[model samples]
Target: MTPNTARRNEASRRAVLTAAFDLLQEVDYAKLSIEGIAARAGVGKQTIYRWWPSKGAVLFDAFLMLSEGAGGEPPMLPDTGDLEADLVLVLRATVDELNDPRFEPPMRALSTEIAHDPELAAAYAERLDGPLREAKRQRLRSAQQAGQLAQGLDLEVAVDMIWGPVLNRWLQRTGPLTTEYTDLVVTTALNGLRPRGSSS
Candidate 1:
């Protein structure tokens, strides 16, 4: 495509994603329609259909676009040589995002899709979860190297142990997702995850 044509296409794509995200904020998921999105975006419905197969796909891209901002990457977990402090920082940020009204509906929608839609679930695994989970595992590896965590600990389980509580609480709505709760959770998890002493 020509440079002008490419720029126009990029603009339209961003506009469509923005419109879908904004509509999800204002309307029920069931009420969101391609026609409405196209109208809001000032693009033809065919333009949306040409690029995406279904409303779910558009919603997925919109969620990704917003979550990634302009970077085309998920935000990285910080590693400051202090695993507990780093995890607490990451978890507290997660709490903030979960508590945000702007992120809630789309996150809810994506969670539903992840539970039932195999294709979207795989896409999420490959595109979003995979990178993020790897980052967590890498940080855990650093802690192990530093003698801060168990030498033979299973990274996956370690990851779950560190993060599972808050995610469970958020999804089940069993408790408040507060910074205080995340702080306590991080401290408690670190206590359990500390390097076990060698036995005779």
Candidate 2:
């Protein structure tokens, strides 16, 4: 397609996604529908179905777009060669994004659905979770190579150490997810949450 056509298509797609995002805030996942999305988007119902197989798919992509700079599909992590600083930088940004109203509603809905639906969970794993996990894992691997991460660290668990608390506070809304809290998570996870050299 020509550049103009490509741009127009992108704009139209974004409009559809934006409409879906807005609708998701007002309705639960089970109630969300492609017909409803197309109505909200000012497009034909077939337009939505032609592009996405399910409402979940549409919302997942919408969330991905909204969360782009907020630790989801970020162009790059804060790689200053200082692992703690880098991690704190990214995690702090993530906390701020999670706190934002734009990312909160759809995120809450999608996560809630994932708990009860195995099929949606698997689809989420393939499309959403895998990429995000891989991104975190890549950053951790970089830290290890830089000699900042612990040698022979279980990369998966190490990733959880960094990701868990931030997500916990963000999703559960149980505690403050301040920059200070993120900084502490960075320091604790990297240097061990216990006394120096003591197993956590």
Candidate 3:
């Protein structure tokens, strides 16, 4: 493709993503349609179909884009050699992101839709959960190698335990999502993972 063509394509893609994200905040997922997205994006319906198969697919990509940090940096789990500190940092950031106005509504919409749609849930897991889980798994592995975590520990379970409380609270709206809560969760989880007889 020529340089100008590539730029135009990129611009169109960005416009579509932005429109989908904004529309999610304005309309319920059940009410959000591909035609609406195309209209809001100032592109034809065929343009959206040329890129994604369905509105769910478009919304999924938009969610992933928003999760990317400012300037489009990929979402990351920090590894600072201190497992507890790293987990705390990551979870605290998660709490903030969950509370952010731009993310909260879209995420709530996606969560609601995913609860009833297996295919969309699978897509969300593949596109968003996969990377986040892998990042946490890698961090746990590093901790194990450094003797910070107990040997033979199930890293997957460890990742879930660390995140379970925070997610539960977010979804249930049962409690405030504070940094202090995240710090406590991280500390409790790390305490369990630490080598036997080692005090955290």
Candidate 4:
């Protein structure tokens, strides 16, 4: 493609992704449709179809774009040499994300939909959950290598242990998801993982 054509294609793609992201803040996932996205994006419906196979695919891509940090990289958990502090930082960010008005409604909507839709669940896992879990696992492994975590810890299970409670509260709405709650979860999990008698 010519330089101008490539620039135009990139611009069009950005427009669609931005429009979809913005629209989700106004409407639930069930109410979001390809036609609405195209209209909001000021592009032809075919323009979106040529890029994404379905509305869910478009939303998934938009979600990723929204979650990206500076330089278009997915947000990374911080590494501060203190495992507990790092975990708390990451978990607090998660709690804030879950509480964010722009993200919460769509995320909750998608979660409910995924429970009944196996295909959607798989897509969600592939795009979001799987990568996030892997990132957390890698951070835990780093702590183990630093001798901050107990030897022989099952990193995968440890990751689940760290995230499971936060996710449960998020999904069940059984309690307020606050900074204190996240800090408590992180402290509790790390206390168990730390080598015996090691200072937290």
In the range 1-200, model 3's lDDT, one tens digit per residue, is: 99999999878888899998998778877798888999999989998999998777787778777767345554567788888888888888899989998888778877877887899899888878888788789889988999988898999898889998899899889999999999999887876654756453
**Per-residue error (Å), model 4, residue 115:** 4.4
What is the C-alpha RMSD, rounded to one decimal, of candidate 2?
4.2
Give the distance in Å from residue 74's predicted Cα in candidate 1 to where it truly belongs: 7.0
Q: lDDT order of candidates, best first?
A: 1, 3, 4, 2
Task: Give the Å error, residue 163, model 3.
Answer: 1.0
Per-candidate TM vs. native? 0.86, 0.76, 0.80, 0.80
After superposition, candidate 3 runs with Cα above 4 Å error: 1-10, 66-76, 192-200
Query: Which TM-score value belongs to model 1?
Result: 0.86
Which candidate tops lDDT? 1
Model 2 CA lDDT for position 36: 83
TM-score of 2: 0.76
Q: RMSD, model 4, all Cα superposed? A: 3.5
Candidate 1: count of backbone clashes, pairs at least 3 residues apart or interchain: 0
Task: Estimate candidate 1's RMSD in Å.
Answer: 3.1
Q: After superposition, how far is residue 189 of candidate 2 from its true place, in Å?
A: 1.2
Score each candidate by Cα lDDT: 0.86, 0.80, 0.84, 0.82
Residue-by-residue lDDT tens digits, candidate 1, 92-176: 8899999899988877777776778899989988877788899899888988999988788999998898788988898778988
Candidate 1 lDDT (Cα, 0 to 1): 0.86
Error of 2 at 186 (Å): 1.2
Shift in Å, residue 100, candidate 3: 0.3
Per-residue lDDT, model 3, residue 68, is 70
lDDT of 4 by residue, 74-99 (tens): 54678888888888888888888899
